[model samples]
Target: MKPYKNKINRIRSFALALIFIGFVVMYFGIFFKQYPLVMVIFMVLGLLCIIASTVVYFWIGMLSTKAVQVVCPNCGKATKMLGRVDMCGHCREPLTLDPELEGKEFDESYNRKKPAQSGE
Candidate 1:
């Protein structure tokens, strides 16, 4: 199974990646100094990536405010969760709001509209 990360943290990581990518693209553009047009294009694209990251960061910041804050039982630290199932940000422990899901194997489908079933 794929590793799970809190939605907020995952989104934040993506935004961080965008920042890195933007800087790398801009740096690579420096190699094309002789071709001003190409260099400018790369610079502009990189700037757009940075701008997109900023927007994503702003959006996630708002979404974070609306997330449910709960103390992790395993780690005893406060963390935010967006859906019914998510991992603890501090300890990576699986957590769920539904009592039925407690102690069950962590499954992303638990957050879906339809109830998760044992048999697929």
Candidate 2:
């Protein structure tokens, strides 16, 4: 079975990675300092990455505020849930808001809208 992480955490992780990547790219720009044009290009690209990271961070912050907060039964810690099916942020326990999905095998697909089944 594939391991699942809370959506909010995953997005935050991605944003953190972007910040690191931006710094690394900026460092690489130093190597081309002898060529002013090349160095400028690298610096600009790196700056753009950092700017994008800032946007992502801002977006995630806004998104987090809107996510539903629930106290995890498994860990007894308060965590945020994004969709109908999400893992507990503290314990990786599967959580669901829908009664029908409760006690059933955890599936991320449950959060997605299903297409109508057509009968021939």
Candidate 3:
């Protein structure tokens, strides 16, 4: 099966990983302390990663506002859905907003086109 994840959860995980990578990069900067310029470069790069992560977090906040909240039938919990096809946050069950797409293959592409052009 194609690997699918709750969109919000996946984005959250990505933000978390970015933070970790930022720290790791910053730590590596210490090794270049002998070369002050190199150390500064590493530090700047690391800081940029962290700042990018913060931006991504802000983006999530924006996306959250646009996400639809639904109760997952599989897990019976409130979850957020982005686009048309998304997996349940709690149970990873595929869910869709379009009736015609339900019970059919789950494809992220389903969310990309206008319903009128999707050929149903």
Candidate 4:
């Protein structure tokens, strides 16, 4: 079985990872102390990563406001959900707002817009 996580949580994790990567990159810059230009470049790149992470965090905040808050049937905890299918943050229970999708296997692709199909 595929391990699934709340969409918001996944994005948040990505943002957190970016921050760590930024710090790691900056730490490497310290090793190039003998070459001023190279050290400067590394520092700049690291700063950029941090900035990008900050942007991603801000985006997550915006998405949070748009997501639906519902109590998970399995976990009995309030969880935020986005798109057609989402998992409970607390228990990893699959959730969906669409009645048609109820009882069906969870598929993330359902959230994406599908192109019109022509008759075969």
Superposed Cα deviation of residue 52, candidate 3 (Å): 0.3
Report each candidate's C-alpha RMSD, comma-separated, in the order given: 1.9, 3.1, 3.2, 2.7
Candidate 1 C-alpha lDDT tens digits along 1-120: 788898889999999999999999999899999999999999999999999999999999999999999999998999999889999998899989989888898988888899767787
- Residues 2-120 of candidate 3 have per-residue lDDT tens digits of 88898898998999898889889889999987899998888888898899999999999899999999998988999989988899999999998889887998877787765445666
Q: What is the lDDT of residue 36 in candidate 1?
A: 100
Can you write out model 4's per-residue Cα lDDT over 19-76, one digit (the tens) per residue?
Answer: 9999999999999999999999999999999999999999999999999999999989
Better of 1 and 2 by lDDT: 1
Report residue 76 deviation for candidate 1 (angstroms). Answer: 0.5
Question: In terms of TM-score, how similar is model 4 to the real structure?
Answer: 0.94
Which pairs clash in model 4? none
Off by over 4 Å in 3: 114-120
Clashes of 1: 0
- Residues 1-120 of candidate 2 have per-residue lDDT tens digits of 999999989988888888888888888889998898888888888888889888988998999999999999998999999888999998999998889888998888777788335483
Candidate 3 global CA lDDT score = 0.88
Q: Lowest summed lDDT over 10 consecutive residues: which window, candidate 1?
A: 111-120
